[model samples]
Target: MSSSDGTAADASWERSDGRSRPPPTVNTIRRIRQACTNCRHRKTRCSGERPRCMNCRRVDRVCHYEPYSTTNPPSSASVAANNGAAKGKSPSSLFPRAGVVDISRLPLATRKSRQSSPSHRLLSINIRLPPPSPQTPFPTCQVQCMRFTTAPPPAVMDHLIDAYFLHVHNQPYSYFHEQSFRERVNYGLIPKCLLFAILASALKFSDIEYFQGSIREATEAYAREAWLAILHEHLTVENNPTLAERTLTLLTLFYIGGRTSSGWLKIGLAVRIAQDLQLMREPKNTMPPIEQEEHRRAFWSIYLLDKLVSVGQSRPPAIAEEDIHVQLPSDEETLRRGIWKKTPTLHQLINWKSETESSVNGTFTQTILAATALGRCCRYVLHGREMDEMPPWDPRSDFTLLNTFLLLIDHHLQVETPSIPQIVEHYRRPDGTLDFQSLEHVVFARIVFHTAHCLLNHPFLLRMRLQKSNCKVPPKFLTRSFQISCNHARSISSLVEDAIASGCHVQSSFYAYASILAGGILSLAIHIDQEKGQVTDPETLNHYQKAIHILERTGRRWDHASKMVSLHCLFRAIL
Candidate 1:
């Protein structure tokens, strides 16, 4: 301003003087046109330059100038519109915002995003399909939307499904029915939660390590999605009992992948749902053959799980023996072929003998029967001890009840004993190592049976110890019980070592529990022998060390195994 005014005044004075004024002395100075966004927001001066100015470069800030325009700058919306125009599309069409779908255009239950990756995509694809009208056999629109949103490529889905059936479903205690599950997946009739659970389980069992790292993340994401879907759809067992039960069962497995406590919680929910569906009762003969068989299988599966979980967690069984009227499950082949056959109850099977084979022959039917007996024995022992320890207890009455239970367990063991030699012969190879893959279920069953025997006789052995300590001669029956308990404990340890040598210990969940049980008994025996000034057997000490090693290896995969290992170490130190 000073230069311009001074030059104008000098020019005006020269003109007034009517003389040709020499060019007014002028000074050239460059003015800044604009500042960068950072400088302008900070109210700092900036030299306008092509890339960066000295002021911005000195302070390590980016410098930029607004475009020179005679007209006003365009708004965000206008800029977006120009972008859309350049791409030959409307702005609204280019940017598809969530929650913009018209609710009135679809059924209330079908109001979910069809886009593959929604903000809540990992929550669950739990959108409920509207009930089909008499005019329509299926809710086509809902099914279509579900497929579009949650279903993976057919090839990938097929591989995962096959993997699950091969690795998980084929296990003796698994609950899923292959034919029905396959149909549901093929037709997109499965719930999103179940689908994700299946995928998570399959991925977990995949041998590829790269995929295993992803498995945990994918499982968590799918689990969250499934839960969100449940909430959004307001799913209840009353409205959809079948889906609810299936989802709960799959969720139990999902929890078993990492969180043992949560797995138990899901198993509890599954039990309640099974009861709600009247799965405790045998199916009526009037129902379709497939439905009848499926009902029977489902009930028995839940029963097996109830017993397994009870024994595994050292808790009482949820499905009472008296409450179940459903028959035992048939062999896998018969079930797979959809052949329905009436089977005897577990109690009847306990007394029933096969003339062709005196003991359980490692068949699925026989294994489950043995498991049922073992479960009952475990419960009786656990409950009997509780009763004996209760305030105002009658020692004579409790002892009588305990003895009666022991006699019953003894009879059950006698019936199951002959199968042991037969199983060992069947699975042993020429080289003398057990065929682990083929015999894992059989070995696990044997371990459970023997462990139950040990548990049943341990208390009697303790009584004998007390009697001996008091210088009173123990009864012949008490001495026999002690010897039998030691034999069973030794057998358990032998089986664990065999399984480990076969490289199949990790394949079964029972391995860790069986190892801990056997090790604890051996440790107790060693402690007792030491207190009596008797030399501890070298073989027994070796078995205890082997048990510790097995638990250490198992701990790498299961948190429960690690805890058991710690407890075993502490107990050993104390002894």
Candidate 2:
């Protein structure tokens, strides 16, 4: 909430009313712009403290703050007007109320409720058109629907669209090419479901207005409207790609985690749609190269999401590596230029040799490679225990295979990826807009890389593997793996530190999960040290603090992030 109230000078001294009322002797107590959820619900004064406020502390609860949109205090003139049957009442929620023109009805969208505050904007939009014209291009039914559509004005859509490319257009949620999507929006050619999906997911980051108060509500509102729009749409071979895009967008609403999204079912639908379109295989006909890239990028985007959303969970990914046959996507630049180039398939990248490392690898290609490694790492942790098992120290074991795959990924990163600082610098354009897609690959690569390391050497996983096999493993190997996990835990924190310092924000809630998972390693160690009555390493504690810091920053935008902050502050290690 940017404000104009604080800068007026001599306000206290000038008692303009000219009654015997004098200025107060005490100075005003400054308050934060918004209160914590509990304080707001209780209608109590909130100190707006970090992590936990005084009221939350009193109740032994987590202090949560979803990004809020509050209307400015009404002036006396407007206050008087609100009482009358006036033409211009202030907009109530961020989006308009349903069936209220200009406070338009929702589109084909989802209506699933989340565990959040009720004081939220219903995600809806409206354009307030003149009486229907014969020249209107829409069908009569669509024309009727458009009058109640709650879509924002074009100017606001511009901001939300920009935010989408900057924040939501990369990693676990990449569905559209920047150039093509913007062109569609410019031409009024984008599907309502896709447009609203982008708006809903990008709303929290946009910080445009106070939708009555809760931005999350407004965001979820957009999702609901998009869902409504999609329901009436006829699903067919030609519409399968758009349907996949819509489903993936809905799944991305789960970024902050929690009950906000039905990721599994949505992603399954998206993946199956891509497979049905034969997106996994390269095109065989006279299809343009640009069209081929679109198909490849779309499929890989789903693949990237599958890899990210499935981590630390029990189920397998929808698109297995073996099932994918298309070449990986090209770089952002080429995609923007609508050009395609020779690229490696998933297998070629995974089975890389030093002599045959001649494939042209771009940022997106690197991201795909990193995601594949992450998938393999996850599989190793969750399902690598084959019935015909070998000793932990054996060369032919699952552990060894994981190590080998990790090395392959490391080699590719070393060969193709830019340094973190270089990527940050590259993100800043001369025109002042950020090239977030470029920076996203680096962020995703680093996050996935370190997160996989943390997952691989997780102490519980280590202990379970050893216990299950009952094999005589070398102490040195086990000791080194522990060292590796600890190093990567700190590495995860370092990634956050660098991201913040460089102003390259961690855009996804999935990235925050990495930091939390990394913190778990240190948390387990400190807990163990406490049980043994020994001193924990100071350096380890510092890294743990950094992890918490990222979570706190993310919490301001995301409720689940805020919830995690509350949980971490209590110092429990369900790592």
- Backbone clashes for every candidate come to 3, 21
TM-score of each: 0.61, 0.71
lDDT of each: 0.58, 0.67
User: Model 2 lDDT vs. the true structure?
Assistant: 0.67
Query: How well is each residue in 172-226 modelled by candidate 1, as lDDT tens digits?
Result: 4555557876775555466666676667666545654323324455455556445
What does the lDDT read for residue 453 in candidate 2?
82
C-alpha displacement of 261 in model 1, angstroms?
Answer: 3.9
lDDT of 2 by residue, 424-528 (tens): 777688997667777767777867888888888988888887787777878797778877898988888887788777777576777668878888888877788
